[model samples]
Target: MATTDPLGIAEARSQLGTLVARAVHGHQPTTIRRSTTERAVLISEDDYEELLRARRELEAGHVAEAIAAHDRGERETVTYDDRAALYADLGLPTPGERS
Candidate 1:
């Protein structure tokens, strides 16, 4: 079974190889922290991919809802000029502008 306890940065650094072995072969997860702050989590590749898949599903759901709202005319359409101005306001590069 995987341990649920958190490990400090120093300890985790020392036992990184062992922790990685445990996570890969034993399907265990190690939570590494810096002082009292949670820093990173070590998990098996399967778990990491699962997290990515879940995130993608969540984003897809949001997109679908937005599309439905747009079909119902619940959202206002913006012109290209408006989009360019909004992007400039947010300090984001325009479609063709390089960073």
Candidate 2:
């Protein structure tokens, strides 16, 4: 199981790799906090890459196109079962699923 914690700067620096490993194994998100500020996240490489791709697409305005497609019914509505189908179409993994 994944373990998560909010850590101070020193703790984060020391535990970064282990926290990242936990995230990769589908453990709960590890948040590094400094004072009242949230510092960083420990997440899988795949999750990081997915975040990058999504950010890139949003920057390029592809997000608007996807929204438009959904509005126009070109993409099927995201019903419960269709969630995976939608992710599959977008070449993304089901983010919360781990076994």
Best prediction by TM-score: 1
Which regions of candidate 2 fall more than 4 Å away from where they truly are?
1-5, 13-17, 62-99
Candidates' lDDT values, in order?
Answer: 0.75, 0.67
Which structure among the candidates has the greatest lDDT? Answer: 1
Cα miss at 20, model 2 (Å)? 2.3
Error of 2 at 59 (Å): 1.7
Residue 68 alpha-carbon offset, candidate 1, angstroms: 0.8
TM-score, each model? 0.66, 0.46
- 1-99 in candidate 2: lDDT tens per residue? 223456777886887777666778764567777778646666778887887787666544754676788899898765556777866656555557531
lDDT of 1 at 80: 51
RMSD list, candidates in order = 6.5, 11.7
Per-residue lDDT, model 1, residue 69, is 76
TM-score of 2: 0.46
